[model samples]
Target: MRVRRAAKGVGDFVVESIGEAVAEVVLGVLACALLAGLALIAYLSWSFSPLLTVAGTGLLSLFLAHGAWGTFRDPVEGRRRRGWTAVAAVCFTLVAATAAFLLLYASDCGCL
Candidate 1:
């Protein structure tokens, strides 16, 4: 009985450890895809008119925000991976906000 109990405990620990690693991997992949998507959207929209550029980025921001919420809602169990995804979210927001601001400013100037 003692041997069996010890083995069971070890097994549970291993399974739980794997769960955290899986969470980390899943969130990491999501973070990579998100960054790539944002990059693609920016590149594709670069040549569009100022209004359209802002619109494209605005849509991207919505999706990114939703993803971030999801990340926070069910966060990864690993510290390192969670930190990375958080960094990715921050980077996306900063770049998107800057682009949106610049696009709006340019459009306003163009109107004048």
Candidate 2:
């Protein structure tokens, strides 16, 4: 009975940890997107430098990629099959979507 309780506690901790990680990443991405969008609007209307536009988009893309990698890594980093959380899955999905959008924008291909 003691071993079972210990195992359950560990699993709960892992899941809670995963949730916190996912929430942080989501909040980060949302905040960045909002700020970036505002900056982009300002740049477009205020004749901000072309270099700044490129740099801003590049940085945002890198950030999204890192988030995606981190979220995916969190699931299978240390152990074989300890725990799985819906937050991790949701995080991956969100990151993947943002990454896909970036790919299309970078490629400038409508079909992509």
Candidate 3:
């Protein structure tokens, strides 16, 4: 009876805990993407027109917030792979670099 009880407990833990952790990771990655977008907007505004800078920043922020909420609505479970995380990081870095470049280059051109 004790062995059966332990097995049941382990099963429940696996089903419940694993799901929550996966959701957390997914949301976390989404957050990183949004942050990268914001940084990109900042760089744009600093380098170019105020209108575009504000619009870009606002759009990215809204999209990220929405994505975050949507992601949490569903539980994602499957093969735990490192590829998604790597992809997220790469994307964020690209956004940041692009923003920085635009801002710096535009400033030199006297656009902003």
State which candidate has the highest TM-score.
Answer: 1
Quote each prediction's TM-score: 0.46, 0.41, 0.41
Q: C-alpha displacement of 31 in model 1, angstroms?
A: 1.3
- What tens digits encode model 2's per-residue C-alpha lDDT throughout 1-112? 9999999999999999999999866655665665567557967945767778778867766665655555556466565422333444455577667666555443442222
Q: On TM-score, who's better, 1 or 3?
A: 1
Lowest summed-lDDT stretch of 10 residues in model 1? 103-112
Q: Determine the backbone clash count of candidate 1.
A: 0
lDDT of 1 by residue, 1-112 (tens): 9999999999999999999999866655555555557567777777556688988768767767764664556555663335545665776667667566545433333222
The TM-score that candidate 1 achieves is 0.46
List residue ranges in candidate 3 displaced over 4 A. Answer: 50-112
lDDT at 5 for candidate 1?
A: 100
lDDT score for residue 56 of model 3: 74
Model 2: per-residue Cα lDDT at residue 58: 79
Off by over 4 Å in 1: 55-112
Q: Please, what are the lDDT tens digits per residue for candidate 3 over residues 17-80?
A: 9999998666555555655676686786778888876787687666555544443344458733
